[model samples]
Target chain A: MSALLTVEGLRHGFYGVQVLNGASFEVRQGTVTGLIGPNGAGKSTAINAISGALLPQGGRVSFAGTDITRLPPRERVGLGLVRSFQLARGFPRLSVFDHLMLYGQGHPGEGFWQSLTGGRAGRQHEERLAETALSVARRLKLDHVIDNPVSALSGGQKKLVEIGRALMAEPRMILFDEPMAGVNPTLSAQIAEHLTALNEEGITICLIEHDMAMVARLCDPVIVMAEGRKMTEGSFAEVVADKAVQEAYLGVRHDA
Target chain B: MLSYVIFSATTAGIYGLLALSLNLIWGGAGMVNLGLAGFFAVGAYASAILSLAGVPVPIAILAACAMGAAAGIGATWATVRLRGDYHAIVTLGFAEVVRLVAMNERWLTNGTDGLPGIPAPLKSVLGPQGFAVFYLCLVLTILVAVFLALRRLDRAPFGRVLKAIREDQDLAGFAGKNAMRVKLIAFAVSAGIAGLAGALYAHYQSYISPDHFQPLLTIYIFLAVTSGGVGRPAGAFLGAFLVILFLEGTRFLGHLLPGLSSGQVAASREILVGLAFLLVLHLRPQGVLPERIRPAPAQ
Candidate 1:
């Protein structure tokens, strides 16, 4: 299968130390691709580079055959590539409804002058969008708090809201950064289920998770990285059995 | 007393316009605009110069808004890359630069001597006796129009995106929002409104100087927004009224206290206004009306 997203020689660094060094990987279309790495590994940085959040000092990222190396995150989103942050950053002051309403493309009311002139047609369109937002909330079990400020939500709910927000964009692919972190087991499982359901609906997912059990269960053709380079790419079992993988994690010295 | 009421009401209306603009930027869009007076100065000077040159008032007002928006765009463009306090500091400096230019360029602004005899166009149409009343109505109408427009946009996708931008710009961008672009629109619009207010203020007062457009004016608007409720339009409106009254009510202290001089009364007024601001911040940090739980559903 053709790759939906490809990262070639992704190299990035902070002021002094390099975090991602020549990290390269391929995400197959419509697959739940897992990017797993140990601490100080470049998994998050690589995801950032791929998502256009952090521009890589050197590398190339192509999405759906389009060279997006220089595309801003906003334009990348317009092209149906969306990402969620490690900590769900919902607008704390906005309601659950506003969260989803803020998404989508070419909202009729986005422009000040257009909204004023849009009149009844505009109001009707907005009603339809609101109903859709409400239905989406109901699907996510967030209908109960649809009118409440995001600040009123629990951590797990916030994560769901984040995912819901990504869905609002009608994205072809979602880059999730630690969606399972700081979430309850039940919600985590629910999230896993939702992700699977979404994948079943033909949406591709790239997940960064510390939950190996989930990575094992959900991800296919797992890609592992260490110190900013792809260590190996294979099935969960095959990658685990690799000697380099063993050395990177355990630091176990082997004599020639 | 009637004249005082009309005068006070007109002043309050102008301040209300300024407060509404600031609230939209700082409160709604979540970007603090410390250089509000810069835009206001730009609008005032632009309108004053245009009208003095025999340009019609409407055209001059529009020109003022255009100049103000241009300045707003310039300010945001220069500082868009900065975050939080850095943006604030840069804008504040922008206002200072405006003041210095006005002060130094004696040939244009007439330096500290100020521009005098600014025509009150309303007086020409409505006649002088009821001119204050007419002027009051005009400013109020504008305030209401701006408030309504903001209220409509507040729920629209633009305002909703602004809310998102305010709370979390990066997340908003992640959802495909052009955060900077949205902010630029908000900043420019807010600045335009403030510029409009400055034009009205210059014409209403019939004279303006470099000292008229000061950081103190910006501070007053900030005080109004904080007191009224940061993101609430009605709160901003009410805030302007309350603040003006509170500041003006202090003027009565000179009359009440036998020993109090005019200068002492002025000092006391500042103290009281400061105290009220601090008290509001302490007691009702969200202002009288907090940001509402329910936003309009569509946006």
Candidate 2:
């Protein structure tokens, strides 16, 4: 399959501390790619640079053959690139149903004039979107608390809602930043299932996660990063077995 | 007596609208905006100028709202990239710049003397009695509409994204929300509402000056929202009412204390207002009407 996203020689830093150095990777279409590394391995930094949250000092990022290295985060989103955080962020004061509807409304109905006088068409569109969102909520098993504020949701539920929000954007590619962090076993399974299903439906995913087992289960190809650079890339089994990957995780042994 | 009560209530109602706008940015969206006075001043000046030029009242009101929205956009452009204290400082600077421009632009704003004798809406049709009633009803209607719209927005997904931005901006960005754009919009809407209130004030009072759009007025509205509950739309109304009541009710106290001069009474009122604000912050840090904490829906 053709590459959906390509990053070449990406470099980023904060206050003279280099976070991502000469990182290179490619995300294939309709595939789930897992990015794993130790703490401060620059996993999130790579995602930020690719998603345009942090501008890389040097490198190229092309999404579907378009250079997106300098595109703003919203522009990237407009181009069907979306992302989720390790820590699920929801509007605590907003209802779950409203959350979904807002994301759906991202397409066309949010303009001031449209919101003010879009009239029955707008209302009807919102209704249809809400209905569709409710169905998605049902699949996520978040149907009952649709009207509840996100603040009231458990940690895992918030993660599901975050995923739901990304789905609402109808993006072709989504970057998952530790979706399984702090989630329960049951919820983790549910998330894994959802991701698997999404991948089956031809959505491209780049997941930054610490859980190797979950990454192995859901991701087809795995990329490893160490100290702001790409250490290795292959099947999860191959990458885990690499001596360099092990040393990167466990540190250099004097015996070796 | 009824007239006085209605007048106070109507004034409070306009202030309530202003507070609601401020609450959206400061309380709901976690933006520390201090340029509200600028937006408010623009609305007041725009409406007053249009009315003096013989424009119809509805058109003048629209002009005022447009000016207010423009001011909002301006403020957003200035401070949207800034964070926390820096943002607050930029907004404060913008308010000062606006006030200075209003004071110096003699051709447009008539300098510090201000434009007076501006006609209220429907004045010819309603006369004094009818005009007061009509204008009060108009202002109240707008307030109600704003209240409803804000309430709806507060419950919607857009509001959720704003809250998410408030809690963790970086995370919100990852969640496909453009945090800067959202904050900018929130700031603009908040300023627009404040500007609308200024327009109403200009028409009702039939006069406006740079003095009328002082930074202190912005601070006073901030007090209302902070005391009422920062993020609650209803709290904005409650806060405004409480503020006006506290300020105006003390007039009776001045009358009771015959020995005190008018100047003394004014000074005392300021002192008391400050003290009351401190007391409220100490006692109910979240204000009188705290943000409603809705539970997560049942599984």
Candidate 3:
């Protein structure tokens, strides 16, 4: 598969504390790429830079042959690249269906005049989007609480809503920042299966995860990051065997 | 007595329009527009000036809306990056500046001497009593139209996007909704609504002054929104009327404090409004008729 997203020399800092220091990587078109690193290793910062949540001070990020380094988050989403937060964030009082429908593919029926008039075309578009939202809910097993406010949902369910929001965008690639963090093991397994199924459906995913076991099970060509840059990349076992990886994690020098 | 009642109702309708405008920015999109009085003053002054310049009343009213929208856009652009308390403070400052300009700019706003005998629309076509009733109908019709438009907006995708942004702007942006553009449009539309209300007020009263568009007026509208329901149009409409009634009802209580001066009676009314606001906030923080949307039926 071709590279769907490329980040070259990404450098960013917050108030003089450099978080991402020349981190570079590529997300291939048809694989679930795992980005694993220790705390403050710039995994989340890289995702932020790629997703347009924050602009990197120095970097060139190109997605699908277009330079999106300066594109705003909304425009990036329009180009079929979307991202999710580590913690689920959404409209507080809005129902799940409303939440899903609000982020519908291409933001249909959102024109100001069309909204005011409620023309037949807009209504038809809304109905179709609603149908899609219902199917997404059913697939995520969220149909039971589709009418409930997202704020009232369980943590795991809220995580699913975060994924569901990305799905509604019809994204080609999704950058997830710890989607399964803080979930119970059983729900984590279910989330793992959902990610697998989505990956099978041709959506590329670059995940930031701390759960090494889950990363080993779900990710291909896992990229290990340390000290704000890519330390190594290989199959899970191969990277695990690297001395540098051991030293970065265990702080023990493995002289070979 | 009947005429007084009709006049009060008309005034309430005008305020209802203002409350609706406030609700759109504050309740719909989570923007605290403390400069509402500034926009209101812009509309009133724009219409008054145009009408006094021999321009047609209808055209002048439309121009007033445009002017108000311009002010909204300008204010939003200037403070685009400010949020929460910062936004509120900046907007409050903007309103004060507008009031000061009206006070000092003698050539434009008459330097607080105020504009008098502003032409009332359709006044010459109808007798005084007939005009009052006719004006009431006109205001009512406009209010209903605005209310319906806002209701349509509440259920529409535009409103959904607004709610999304209101909840989490960054998340909304990730969802491909342009938060800034949406906010600008919302502000312009909201300010235009305020402007329309102001023009209607000027025409009905046949006079307007800088003192009329005080920050206190903005506070009253904000109270109406908070007490009724923040995000609900019906709540705002009813809240305005309810607030006006409260202000008017205090008149009867003034009789009980018979020894108080007229100034004290006015002060007591303000104090009463403050107490009522605190009571509502303490009892029903989400507002009397909190925002609630019925789920769409199963497909």
**Which candidate should be chosen as best, given lDDT against the real structure?**
3
In candidate 1, which residue pairs clash?
none
Best-first order by lDDT: 3, 1, 2
Quality of model 1 by C-alpha lDDT: 0.86
Model 3 lDDT per residue over B163-251, tens place: 88888888888888899999999999999999988898888888888899899999999999899999988889889998989888887
Q: Model 1, range A43-85, lDDT digits (tens) per residue? A: 9888888888889999899999999998888889988899888
Score every model by TM-score: 0.94, 0.84, 0.97
Cα lDDT, model 2, residue B74: 80
Every candidate's DockQ is 0.61, 0.25, 0.74
lDDT of 3: 0.89
**For every candidate, C-alpha RMSD to the true structure in Å:** 2.7, 3.8, 2.1
For model 3 the TM-score comes to: 0.97
Model 2 superposed RMSD (Cα): 3.8
Total backbone clashes of candidate 2, pairs 3 or more residues apart or in separate chains: 0
How well is each residue in B123-179 modelled by candidate 2, as lDDT tens digits? Answer: 877887777777779888999899888876765445656676777676565555678
Candidate 1 per-residue C-alpha lDDT over B164-279 given as tens digits, one digit per residue, 9 for 90 to 100:
88888887777778888888988999999989999998888779999998798898988988999888888899999988988888888546777877888777778888888899
Indicate the DockQ of the complex predicted as candidate 2.
0.25
